[model samples]
Target: MNENEKIREEILNTVNGLSDEQLNANPEKGRWSIIQVLDHLYLMERAITKSIADKLKSDERVQAVDKPIELTVNRDVKVEAPSYVVPSDSFQTLDEVKDKLAESRSAFVQLVHNADENDLEQKSFPHPLFKDLSLKQWIPFVGFHEKRHLLQIEELKSKL
Candidate 1:
């Protein structure tokens, strides 16, 4: 979680000077804008947090092997964003997205801090590409996922 916080701070610093218009500008026809990327991160975090909470409260226990989830940061292999996590095209301010991000992160942190490590390791959830991932792995996976988009955000900023 410390590492995740560092990455999150880096992301915020990366966009510190930009205007809202720059954040919302699309780099190309098919690509997402910077704000959209941030929004996607927020949505993904919230969804993962909820899923973890659900699994923790359930009696189901499916042990899963740890995956190379760090591979998530590799941009060479393109994975489509799940529809639920896809960001809207509407313009959004950084503060708006940041608030959403904060709320999601707060919930995620609270859940993680309260959850038992053994419970997290015993439960599993399916990832589209990674198959069934343990809840234990899902925690850091969020950070890796954010790191992936941080690179994308940098690219989008360059184009803007």
Candidate 2:
């Protein structure tokens, strides 16, 4: 399996048996619940996949920087979610979150399969925190983003 697929599998495995209470309970007043984190991850994945697909179809291409991956993968720096990608209380159950994540991940995998290797490196999309990133970088960014939240989920679980 590819790195992206491995990461996706790991995330699904990590949250496989979480109850609704566990998923929705926030560890602290200002902190996000596991469900909220998953929702944000789904939103970000869907948005990033769409952005990369759009960029691939467009005639425009931008020079991608190498630093975006570094910045995104760095766990020490906490970056706030953009307004558009922020999670809401819309998800009432863990099943609902799982459905959305499955749909988004399927679309993401399809986009990756359909894209050319050259185009993956050439096409660029705007990231809220890191600015423009190539399709290649964006795929892995999804994984890293999930991994980051996995740590949060673990912390939340501990508090429960």
Candidate 3:
């Protein structure tokens, strides 16, 4: 399997069998709960997929940066989630969040599969933190983003 698939599986494994209470409990003040993190992940995934689709349909092309993945996956630089992608309290249960996450992941995987390999390196979109990233870079960036939140989830879980 590819890196995306591997990371997807890891994400599922990380959150699997978590109780609603565990998912909703905040580890500390002014921090996100496990479900909130999942909600953010789903929101960002959908947004990124839409961004890539829009860029693919456009006639514009941009230069692919060297080591774009390195720039995105760096954990040292803290970035705030844009208001558009922030998670809401609409999801009442862990199951609801998981269902949306599964749907978003399916859409993201399909988008990656349907994209042209050659075009992936040519097309670009603005990342909240990384400025501009090619389609190819964005795919793995999703997994890396998930992994970052996975650590947060683990920390939240420990607090319970």
Q: What is the C-alpha local distance difference test score of each model?
A: 0.94, 0.80, 0.79
Question: Residue 135 lDDT in model 3?
Answer: 87
The runs of at least 3 residues in candidate 3 whose Cα sits more than 4 Å from the true structure, single-residue gaps closed, are 71-74
**Candidate numbers, best lDDT first, in rank order:** 1, 2, 3
lDDT value for model 3 = 0.79
- How would you encode candidate 1's per-residue C-alpha lDDT over 16-80 as one tens digit per residue? 89999999998888999999999999999999999999999999999999999999999999999
Highest-TM-score candidate: 1
Q: What is the C-alpha RMSD of each candidate to the true structure, in Å?
A: 0.6, 1.8, 1.9
For candidate 2, write residues 1-160 as lDDT tens digits.
1766776677777777888887888779988888898888889989988888888898887869755464555668888788988888654697888899999989988888889888888878777777787878888888877777777777787887
RMSD of 3: 1.9
lDDT of 3 by residue, 133-156 (tens): 888888888888877776677778
Backbone collision count in every prediction?
Answer: 0, 0, 0
Highest lDDT: give the candidate number.
1
Kindly report which residue stretches of model 2 are placed more than 4 angstroms away from their true locations once superposed.
68-71
- Worst-scoring 10-residue span by lDDT in model 1: 1-10
| Order of candidate numbers by TM-score, starting with the best | 1, 2, 3
